[model samples]
Target: MTKEANAAYDSSWTFIFAWLLLGISLLISGVRDLYDPAASAWTTWLGFISSAVFLLMAVNGMRLRRRRRESAEPAGAAS
Candidate 1:
């Protein structure tokens, strides 16, 4: 990989991991809220929805990384 592409790939991984982390935390919060006496139903729903969105973002990032890697490869390298 070129220097710039390598840098971008590394940064993309960083973002992907960040998204995954956020998703996990939010999912845990949502589940916890479900069992907490004082937690509002709306708060729980919001946490779950937000977690789904973040997890989707992480999945998209992974797809983008695959595309980037494929494009970076030489034309004849695939077969």
Candidate 2:
């Protein structure tokens, strides 16, 4: 694959991995909270922050992939 295709593939994989990680982390946090109702608020807040970061990373990766795809199209193509 060309450099642009490789970059797009990387970005897509990163986004998928980030989303998977975020989902797993959230599941663990939920289970932890259920197991211990008195779990520190900080722990919950940290999970929230981590998930947000992962979500942002995934979104940015998707945007990057989309841009790469658009740029790879022929210049004379209709908008």
lDDT for each candidate structure: 0.66, 0.71
Query: lDDT by residue for model 2 over 1-79, one digit each (tens)?
Result: 9876776677667667666766766777678778885774556576567767766766787787778778878988945
Give the distance in Å from residue 63's predicted Cα in candidate 1 to where it truly belongs: 0.8
TM-score for every candidate vs. truth? 0.53, 0.60
Top candidate on lDDT is 2
**Across residues 1-79, which tens digit of lDDT does each residue of candidate 1 receive?**
9855665676567567666665666676667667883665555566566656655665676677678888989999999
Q: TM-score of model 1 relative to the true fold?
A: 0.53
Kindly report the root-mean-square deviation of model 2 from the true structure over all alpha carbons.
2.8
In candidate 2, stretches whose alpha carbon ends up further than 4 angstroms from where it belongs are 72-74
